[model samples]
Target chain A: EPEVTQTPSHQVTQMGQEVILRCVPISNHLYFYWYRQILGQKVEFLVSFYNNEISEKSEIFDDQFSVERPDGSNFTLKIRSTKLEDSAMYFCASKFNTNTGELFFGEGSRLTVL
Target chain B: AQRVTQPEKLLSVFKGAPVELKCNYSYSGSPELFWYVQYSRQRLQLLLRHISRESIKGFTADLNKGETSFHLKKPFAQEEDSAMYYCALSGQGLTGGGNKLTFGTGTQLKVEL
Candidate 1:
Protein backbone atom coordinates (compact mmCIF):
# COMPACT_ATOMS: atom_id res chain seq x y z
CA GLU A 1 0.00 0.00 0.00
CA PRO A 2 1.14 3.56 -0.70
CA GLU A 3 2.27 5.16 2.54
CA VAL A 4 3.13 8.56 3.96
CA THR A 5 6.89 8.73 4.45
CA GLN A 6 8.71 10.89 6.99
CA THR A 7 12.41 11.50 7.20
CA PRO A 8 14.79 11.67 10.20
CA SER A 9 13.03 8.96 12.19
CA HIS A 10 14.65 10.36 15.36
CA GLN A 11 15.97 13.81 16.21
CA VAL A 12 17.67 15.48 19.15
CA THR A 13 17.92 19.25 19.56
CA GLN A 14 18.69 21.79 22.22
CA MET A 15 16.00 23.96 23.69
CA GLY A 16 15.56 27.21 21.72
CA GLN A 17 16.85 25.61 18.55
CA GLU A 18 14.77 25.12 15.43
CA VAL A 19 13.88 21.77 13.88
CA ILE A 20 12.21 20.80 10.63
CA LEU A 21 10.36 17.51 10.12
CA ARG A 22 9.76 16.37 6.58
CA CYS A 23 7.06 14.22 5.04
CA VAL A 24 6.04 13.06 1.61
CA PRO A 25 2.39 12.27 1.56
CA ILE A 26 0.77 9.95 -0.92
CA SER A 27 0.96 11.49 -4.38
CA ASN A 28 -2.79 11.84 -4.90
CA HIS A 29 -3.69 13.00 -1.44
CA LEU A 30 -5.45 16.36 -1.11
CA TYR A 31 -5.53 16.99 2.63
CA PHE A 32 -2.46 16.88 4.86
CA TYR A 33 -2.11 17.06 8.62
CA TRP A 34 0.36 17.14 11.53
CA TYR A 35 -0.27 15.56 14.90
CA ARG A 36 1.88 14.89 17.96
CA GLN A 37 1.73 12.46 20.84
CA ILE A 38 3.50 13.38 24.01
CA LEU A 39 4.88 10.34 25.82
CA GLY A 40 1.96 8.42 27.27
CA GLN A 41 -0.51 11.00 26.03
CA LYS A 42 -3.21 11.14 23.41
CA VAL A 43 -2.45 12.22 19.88
CA GLU A 44 -3.11 15.94 19.50
CA PHE A 45 -3.78 17.70 16.23
CA LEU A 46 -1.33 20.45 15.41
CA VAL A 47 -2.49 21.77 12.04
CA SER A 48 -4.03 20.93 8.69
CA PHE A 49 -2.97 22.14 5.27
CA TYR A 50 -4.81 22.27 1.96
CA ASN A 51 -4.36 24.27 -1.22
CA ASN A 52 -1.13 25.76 0.09
CA GLU A 53 -2.90 27.37 3.02
CA ILE A 54 -3.44 26.46 6.67
CA SER A 55 -7.02 25.50 7.38
CA GLU A 56 -6.95 25.17 11.16
CA LYS A 57 -4.64 24.79 14.16
CA SER A 58 -4.72 24.04 17.84
CA GLU A 59 -3.65 26.15 20.82
CA ILE A 60 -0.41 24.19 21.01
CA PHE A 61 0.26 25.08 17.39
CA ASP A 62 1.02 28.66 18.24
CA ASP A 63 3.43 31.08 16.55
CA GLN A 64 6.27 28.64 17.08
CA PHE A 65 4.87 26.26 14.48
CA SER A 66 4.31 26.40 10.72
CA VAL A 67 3.61 23.89 7.94
CA GLU A 68 4.39 24.07 4.25
CA ARG A 69 3.84 21.99 1.17
CA PRO A 70 6.67 23.65 -0.73
CA ASP A 71 6.39 21.19 -3.60
CA GLY A 72 3.87 18.79 -5.02
CA SER A 73 5.16 15.97 -2.88
CA ASN A 74 6.91 17.41 0.16
CA PHE A 75 5.16 18.59 3.32
CA THR A 76 7.08 19.93 6.28
CA LEU A 77 6.56 21.11 9.84
CA LYS A 78 8.94 23.66 11.32
CA ILE A 79 9.22 24.40 14.97
CA ARG A 80 10.77 27.84 15.43
CA SER A 81 11.90 27.45 19.02
CA THR A 82 11.88 24.12 20.71
CA LYS A 83 11.28 23.57 24.41
CA LEU A 84 11.78 20.53 26.56
CA GLU A 85 8.05 20.00 26.65
CA ASP A 86 8.10 19.82 22.86
CA SER A 87 9.61 16.36 23.01
CA ALA A 88 7.21 13.89 21.46
CA MET A 89 6.50 11.69 18.47
CA TYR A 90 5.24 13.80 15.57
CA PHE A 91 3.19 12.04 12.91
CA CYS A 92 2.22 13.23 9.43
CA ALA A 93 -0.87 12.02 7.63
CA SER A 94 -2.80 12.58 4.42
CA LYS A 95 -6.17 11.68 2.98
CA PHE A 96 -7.27 11.15 -0.61
CA ASN A 97 -10.64 12.81 0.10
CA THR A 98 -13.29 13.38 2.71
CA ASN A 99 -15.48 10.50 1.55
CA THR A 100 -13.36 7.90 3.34
CA GLY A 101 -12.08 10.12 6.12
CA GLU A 102 -9.25 7.67 6.58
CA LEU A 103 -5.96 9.46 7.21
CA PHE A 104 -2.90 7.48 6.23
CA PHE A 105 -0.07 8.11 8.73
CA GLY A 106 3.70 7.98 8.60
CA GLU A 107 5.89 5.98 10.95
CA GLY A 108 6.42 9.19 12.92
CA SER A 109 9.43 11.37 13.72
CA ARG A 110 10.46 11.18 17.33
CA LEU A 111 11.58 14.64 18.47
CA THR A 112 13.65 15.06 21.59
CA VAL A 113 14.54 18.49 22.92
CA LEU A 114 17.09 18.76 25.68
CA ALA B 1 -15.95 19.42 21.18
CA GLN B 2 -15.91 15.79 20.09
CA ARG B 3 -14.47 13.20 22.45
CA VAL B 4 -13.75 9.46 22.29
CA THR B 5 -13.55 7.29 25.37
CA GLN B 6 -12.05 3.84 25.62
CA PRO B 7 -12.74 2.79 29.15
CA GLU B 8 -10.27 -0.10 29.28
CA LYS B 9 -6.60 0.58 29.25
CA LEU B 10 -5.62 -3.09 29.15
CA LEU B 11 -7.36 -6.31 28.20
CA SER B 12 -6.09 -9.88 28.35
CA VAL B 13 -7.65 -12.93 26.77
CA PHE B 14 -6.61 -16.50 26.14
CA LYS B 15 -6.07 -17.56 22.58
CA GLY B 16 -9.33 -18.55 20.89
CA ALA B 17 -11.42 -16.56 23.36
CA PRO B 18 -13.82 -13.81 22.40
CA VAL B 19 -12.66 -10.22 22.75
CA GLU B 20 -14.39 -6.91 22.66
CA LEU B 21 -12.90 -3.41 22.80
CA LYS B 22 -15.31 -0.75 24.01
CA CYS B 23 -15.54 2.79 22.68
CA ASN B 24 -17.90 5.63 23.45
CA TYR B 25 -18.17 9.12 22.03
CA SER B 26 -19.66 12.47 22.94
CA TYR B 27 -20.64 14.64 20.01
CA SER B 28 -23.53 16.96 19.45
CA GLY B 29 -23.74 16.55 15.70
CA SER B 30 -23.27 13.67 13.33
CA PRO B 31 -20.07 11.82 14.22
CA GLU B 32 -17.65 9.70 12.25
CA LEU B 33 -16.05 6.91 14.22
CA PHE B 34 -12.99 4.73 13.54
CA TRP B 35 -10.77 2.07 15.06
CA TYR B 36 -7.01 2.25 14.66
CA VAL B 37 -4.47 -0.36 15.66
CA GLN B 38 -0.73 -0.29 16.29
CA TYR B 39 1.44 -3.33 16.62
CA SER B 40 4.84 -3.26 18.23
CA ARG B 41 7.45 -1.62 16.01
CA GLN B 42 4.79 -0.72 13.49
CA ARG B 43 3.04 2.45 12.44
CA LEU B 44 -0.51 3.16 13.48
CA GLN B 45 -3.00 2.11 10.83
CA LEU B 46 -6.72 2.18 10.25
CA LEU B 47 -8.52 -1.02 11.12
CA LEU B 48 -12.02 -0.03 10.11
CA ARG B 49 -14.54 2.78 9.93
CA HIS B 50 -18.14 2.77 10.96
CA ILE B 51 -19.50 3.94 7.62
CA SER B 52 -17.84 1.17 5.65
CA ARG B 53 -19.58 -1.57 7.65
CA GLU B 54 -16.99 -4.02 6.46
CA SER B 55 -15.09 -6.59 8.47
CA ILE B 56 -11.35 -6.72 8.24
CA LYS B 57 -9.30 -9.65 9.56
CA GLY B 58 -12.15 -11.04 11.60
CA PHE B 59 -12.55 -7.73 13.45
CA THR B 60 -15.85 -5.86 13.18
CA ALA B 61 -17.25 -2.75 14.76
CA ASP B 62 -20.87 -1.61 14.68
CA LEU B 63 -21.84 1.98 15.22
CA ASN B 64 -24.78 2.20 17.61
CA LYS B 65 -26.00 5.71 17.01
CA GLY B 66 -28.42 5.52 19.92
CA GLU B 67 -25.71 4.46 22.30
CA THR B 68 -23.04 6.70 20.77
CA SER B 69 -20.67 3.77 20.77
CA PHE B 70 -18.57 1.87 18.22
CA HIS B 71 -17.29 -1.31 19.79
CA LEU B 72 -14.76 -3.57 18.05
CA LYS B 73 -15.22 -7.29 18.52
CA LYS B 74 -13.58 -10.52 17.42
CA PRO B 75 -15.07 -13.96 17.99
CA PHE B 76 -11.73 -15.69 18.34
CA ALA B 77 -8.57 -14.04 19.53
CA GLN B 78 -5.14 -14.70 18.12
CA GLU B 79 -1.72 -13.68 19.32
CA GLU B 80 -1.51 -11.25 16.40
CA ASP B 81 -4.53 -9.44 17.76
CA SER B 82 -2.42 -8.33 20.70
CA ALA B 83 -1.84 -4.70 19.96
CA MET B 84 -2.87 -1.24 21.00
CA TYR B 85 -6.30 -0.13 19.79
CA TYR B 86 -7.62 3.39 19.69
CA CYS B 87 -11.07 4.80 19.11
CA ALA B 88 -11.47 8.13 17.38
CA LEU B 89 -14.23 10.62 16.59
CA SER B 90 -14.68 13.48 14.16
CA GLY B 91 -17.69 15.70 13.66
CA GLN B 92 -19.26 18.07 11.09
CA GLY B 93 -16.35 20.50 10.97
CA LEU B 94 -13.92 17.98 9.48
CA THR B 95 -13.39 19.19 5.95
CA GLY B 96 -10.88 21.96 6.64
CA GLY B 97 -9.39 23.61 9.65
CA GLY B 98 -7.41 21.24 11.84
CA ASN B 99 -9.85 18.43 11.05
CA LYS B 100 -8.83 17.28 14.46
CA LEU B 101 -9.30 13.66 15.46
CA THR B 102 -10.26 13.22 19.09
CA PHE B 103 -8.67 9.94 20.06
CA GLY B 104 -9.19 7.92 23.18
CA THR B 105 -6.19 7.15 25.36
CA GLY B 106 -6.18 3.66 23.79
CA THR B 107 -6.52 0.11 25.02
CA GLN B 108 -3.74 -2.47 25.04
CA LEU B 109 -4.91 -5.97 24.10
CA LYS B 110 -2.91 -9.03 25.08
CA VAL B 111 -3.76 -12.47 23.79
CA GLU B 112 -2.12 -15.29 25.70
CA LEU B 113 -1.86 -19.01 25.00
Candidate 2:
Protein backbone atom coordinates (compact mmCIF):
# COMPACT_ATOMS: atom_id res chain seq x y z
CA GLU A 1 0.00 0.00 0.00
CA PRO A 2 1.14 3.52 -0.69
CA GLU A 3 2.01 5.45 2.44
CA VAL A 4 3.10 8.91 3.45
CA THR A 5 6.88 9.37 3.65
CA GLN A 6 8.85 11.89 5.76
CA THR A 7 12.46 12.87 5.28
CA PRO A 8 15.24 13.30 7.84
CA SER A 9 14.00 10.61 10.20
CA HIS A 10 15.85 12.55 12.91
CA GLN A 11 17.29 16.03 13.01
CA VAL A 12 19.26 17.93 15.63
CA THR A 13 19.39 21.70 15.38
CA GLN A 14 20.51 24.56 17.54
CA MET A 15 18.04 26.88 19.17
CA GLY A 16 17.05 29.85 16.99
CA GLN A 17 17.85 27.91 13.82
CA GLU A 18 15.43 27.25 10.99
CA VAL A 19 14.18 23.69 10.46
CA ILE A 20 12.27 22.22 7.56
CA LEU A 21 10.40 18.97 7.84
CA ARG A 22 9.49 17.40 4.54
CA CYS A 23 6.77 14.95 3.62
CA VAL A 24 5.43 13.28 0.51
CA PRO A 25 1.85 12.29 0.89
CA ILE A 26 0.17 9.54 -1.07
CA SER A 27 0.02 10.44 -4.71
CA ASN A 28 -3.77 10.60 -4.98
CA HIS A 29 -4.45 12.05 -1.57
CA LEU A 30 -5.67 15.66 -1.65
CA TYR A 31 -5.53 16.77 1.96
CA PHE A 32 -2.36 16.99 4.04
CA TYR A 33 -1.75 17.65 7.72
CA TRP A 34 1.05 18.21 10.21
CA TYR A 35 0.96 17.01 13.82
CA ARG A 36 3.59 16.89 16.54
CA GLN A 37 3.99 15.02 19.81
CA ILE A 38 6.20 16.29 22.56
CA LEU A 39 7.76 13.55 24.62
CA GLY A 40 5.11 12.03 26.90
CA GLN A 41 2.40 14.31 25.47
CA LYS A 42 -0.53 13.82 23.21
CA VAL A 43 -0.14 14.34 19.52
CA GLU A 44 -1.19 17.90 18.71
CA PHE A 45 -2.42 19.20 15.43
CA LEU A 46 -0.35 21.97 13.95
CA VAL A 47 -1.91 22.71 10.57
CA SER A 48 -3.96 21.28 7.77
CA PHE A 49 -3.52 21.97 4.08
CA TYR A 50 -5.72 21.48 1.05
CA ASN A 51 -5.98 22.97 -2.41
CA ASN A 52 -2.44 24.14 -1.92
CA GLU A 53 -3.38 26.40 0.99
CA ILE A 54 -3.74 26.20 4.72
CA SER A 55 -7.25 25.21 5.71
CA GLU A 56 -6.86 25.47 9.47
CA LYS A 57 -4.21 25.83 12.14
CA SER A 58 -3.95 25.58 15.90
CA GLU A 59 -2.51 28.06 18.36
CA ILE A 60 0.71 26.08 18.36
CA PHE A 61 1.03 26.89 14.71
CA ASP A 62 1.99 30.47 15.30
CA ASP A 63 4.03 32.83 13.12
CA GLN A 64 7.00 30.51 13.55
CA PHE A 65 5.28 27.77 11.55
CA SER A 66 4.50 27.65 7.86
CA VAL A 67 3.49 24.88 5.44
CA GLU A 68 3.78 24.65 1.68
CA ARG A 69 3.09 22.29 -1.17
CA PRO A 70 6.08 23.45 -3.13
CA ASP A 71 5.32 20.86 -5.80
CA GLY A 72 2.72 18.32 -6.82
CA SER A 73 4.24 15.67 -4.59
CA ASN A 74 5.83 17.48 -1.68
CA PHE A 75 4.36 19.04 1.45
CA THR A 76 6.75 20.76 3.78
CA LEU A 77 6.58 22.36 7.23
CA LYS A 78 9.06 25.05 8.13
CA ILE A 79 9.78 26.09 11.73
CA ARG A 80 11.68 29.30 12.14
CA SER A 81 13.95 29.80 15.16
CA THR A 82 13.56 26.51 16.90
CA LYS A 83 13.20 26.38 20.65
CA LEU A 84 13.85 23.76 23.30
CA GLU A 85 10.13 23.15 23.54
CA ASP A 86 10.11 22.45 19.82
CA SER A 87 11.83 19.10 20.24
CA ALA A 88 9.26 16.54 19.23
CA MET A 89 8.32 13.93 16.67
CA TYR A 90 6.45 15.57 13.83
CA PHE A 91 4.06 13.49 11.76
CA CYS A 92 2.65 14.05 8.31
CA ALA A 93 -0.68 12.60 7.34
CA SER A 94 -3.01 12.59 4.35
CA LYS A 95 -6.32 11.25 3.25
CA PHE A 96 -8.00 10.97 -0.08
CA ASN A 97 -11.24 12.60 1.03
CA THR A 98 -13.03 14.04 4.00
CA ASN A 99 -16.02 11.74 3.62
CA THR A 100 -13.76 8.94 4.81
CA GLY A 101 -12.06 9.52 8.12
CA GLU A 102 -9.10 7.25 7.33
CA LEU A 103 -5.87 9.23 7.33
CA PHE A 104 -2.55 7.67 6.39
CA PHE A 105 0.42 8.66 8.52
CA GLY A 106 4.16 8.70 8.00
CA GLU A 107 6.72 7.20 10.33
CA GLY A 108 7.40 10.76 11.66
CA SER A 109 10.42 13.02 11.75
CA ARG A 110 12.07 13.42 15.14
CA LEU A 111 13.39 16.95 15.75
CA THR A 112 15.71 17.72 18.64
CA VAL A 113 16.55 21.33 19.30
CA LEU A 114 19.49 22.06 21.53
CA ALA B 1 -11.62 22.83 22.87
CA GLN B 2 -11.60 19.11 22.00
CA ARG B 3 -9.69 16.68 24.14
CA VAL B 4 -9.06 12.95 24.21
CA THR B 5 -7.97 11.05 27.29
CA GLN B 6 -6.40 7.63 27.58
CA PRO B 7 -6.04 7.20 31.31
CA GLU B 8 -3.60 4.33 31.54
CA LYS B 9 -0.12 4.96 30.36
CA LEU B 10 0.46 1.24 29.95
CA LEU B 11 -1.67 -1.91 29.98
CA SER B 12 0.05 -5.25 30.08
CA VAL B 13 -1.84 -8.48 29.48
CA PHE B 14 -0.98 -12.07 28.69
CA LYS B 15 -1.65 -13.63 25.36
CA GLY B 16 -5.22 -14.86 24.98
CA ALA B 17 -6.43 -12.53 27.69
CA PRO B 18 -9.16 -10.04 26.98
CA VAL B 19 -7.90 -6.51 26.46
CA GLU B 20 -9.44 -3.09 26.78
CA LEU B 21 -7.83 0.30 26.16
CA LYS B 22 -9.95 3.05 27.63
CA CYS B 23 -10.49 6.40 25.95
CA ASN B 24 -12.62 9.38 26.88
CA TYR B 25 -13.25 12.63 25.10
CA SER B 26 -14.25 16.21 25.88
CA TYR B 27 -15.84 17.84 22.88
CA SER B 28 -18.81 20.15 22.85
CA GLY B 29 -19.79 19.42 19.27
CA SER B 30 -20.73 16.11 17.78
CA PRO B 31 -17.35 14.47 17.31
CA GLU B 32 -15.88 11.66 15.25
CA LEU B 33 -13.91 9.12 17.24
CA PHE B 34 -11.19 6.80 16.03
CA TRP B 35 -8.54 4.41 17.31
CA TYR B 36 -5.10 4.36 15.76
CA VAL B 37 -2.34 1.82 16.34
CA GLN B 38 1.41 2.09 15.98
CA TYR B 39 3.59 -0.95 16.24
CA SER B 40 7.29 -0.58 16.92
CA ARG B 41 9.05 1.13 14.04
CA GLN B 42 5.86 1.38 12.01
CA ARG B 43 3.61 4.27 11.04
CA LEU B 44 0.29 4.91 12.66
CA GLN B 45 -2.67 3.13 11.09
CA LEU B 46 -6.40 3.40 11.59
CA LEU B 47 -7.77 0.56 13.67
CA LEU B 48 -11.39 1.47 14.15
CA ARG B 49 -13.78 4.35 13.51
CA HIS B 50 -16.97 4.64 15.52
CA ILE B 51 -19.00 5.64 12.51
CA SER B 52 -18.21 2.42 10.70
CA ARG B 53 -19.22 0.24 13.63
CA GLU B 54 -16.93 -2.50 12.41
CA SER B 55 -14.08 -4.54 13.80
CA ILE B 56 -10.54 -4.70 12.45
CA LYS B 57 -7.92 -7.24 13.40
CA GLY B 58 -10.31 -8.44 16.09
CA PHE B 59 -10.42 -4.99 17.71
CA THR B 60 -13.65 -3.07 18.22
CA ALA B 61 -14.79 0.19 19.78
CA ASP B 62 -18.16 1.74 20.40
CA LEU B 63 -18.92 5.42 20.78
CA ASN B 64 -20.97 6.16 23.87
CA LYS B 65 -22.19 9.70 23.46
CA GLY B 66 -23.61 9.88 26.96
CA GLU B 67 -20.31 8.94 28.52
CA THR B 68 -18.28 10.81 25.94
CA SER B 69 -16.05 7.78 25.49
CA PHE B 70 -14.76 5.50 22.75
CA HIS B 71 -12.86 2.61 24.25
CA LEU B 72 -11.06 -0.04 22.19
CA LYS B 73 -11.41 -3.71 23.08
CA LYS B 74 -10.42 -7.10 21.83
CA PRO B 75 -11.75 -10.49 22.81
CA PHE B 76 -8.42 -12.34 22.89
CA ALA B 77 -5.04 -10.73 22.75
CA GLN B 78 -2.15 -12.04 20.71
CA GLU B 79 1.50 -11.18 21.06
CA GLU B 80 1.37 -9.39 17.73
CA ASP B 81 -1.40 -7.19 19.11
CA SER B 82 1.05 -5.34 21.31
CA ALA B 83 1.37 -1.78 20.18
CA MET B 84 0.81 1.86 21.05
CA TYR B 85 -2.85 2.76 20.75
CA TYR B 86 -4.10 6.31 20.46
CA CYS B 87 -7.64 7.60 20.74
CA ALA B 88 -8.39 10.64 18.66
CA LEU B 89 -11.35 12.98 18.20
CA SER B 90 -12.28 15.46 15.52
CA GLY B 91 -14.93 18.13 15.43
CA GLN B 92 -17.87 17.75 13.04
CA GLY B 93 -16.66 20.81 11.17
CA LEU B 94 -15.70 19.20 7.88
CA THR B 95 -15.34 22.13 5.54
CA GLY B 96 -13.45 21.85 2.27
CA GLY B 97 -11.54 18.84 3.68
CA GLY B 98 -9.59 19.23 6.90
CA ASN B 99 -10.88 17.34 9.89
CA LYS B 100 -8.31 18.19 12.52
CA LEU B 101 -7.60 15.34 14.91
CA THR B 102 -6.97 15.84 18.61
CA PHE B 103 -5.26 12.78 20.01
CA GLY B 104 -4.86 11.42 23.50
CA THR B 105 -1.54 10.83 25.24
CA GLY B 106 -1.89 7.17 24.13
CA THR B 107 -1.88 3.78 25.86
CA GLN B 108 0.89 1.29 25.38
CA LEU B 109 -0.38 -2.28 25.23
CA LYS B 110 2.00 -5.16 25.80
CA VAL B 111 0.70 -8.64 25.11
CA GLU B 112 3.26 -10.78 26.81
CA LEU B 113 3.86 -14.48 26.47
* Model 1 segments more than 4 A misplaced: B94-98
Candidate that would win on DockQ: 2
Interface RMSD of 2: 1.4
lDDT per residue, candidate 1, A37-106, as tens digits? 9999888888888888887777899999999998789999999999999999999999877555688999
Clashes per prediction? 0, 0
Name the DockQ score for candidate 2: 0.76
CAPRI-style quality class for the chain A–B interface of candidate 2: medium
lDDT tens digits, residue span B11-105, model 1: 99999999999999999988889999999988889999999999998999999989999999999999999999999886654455435577898
Report the lDDT tens digits of candidate 2 across residue range B1-113: 88899999999999999999999999988889999999999988998899999999999999999999899999999999999999999785447857888899999999999
lDDT score, candidate 1, position B113:
98
DockQ, candidate no. 1: 0.61
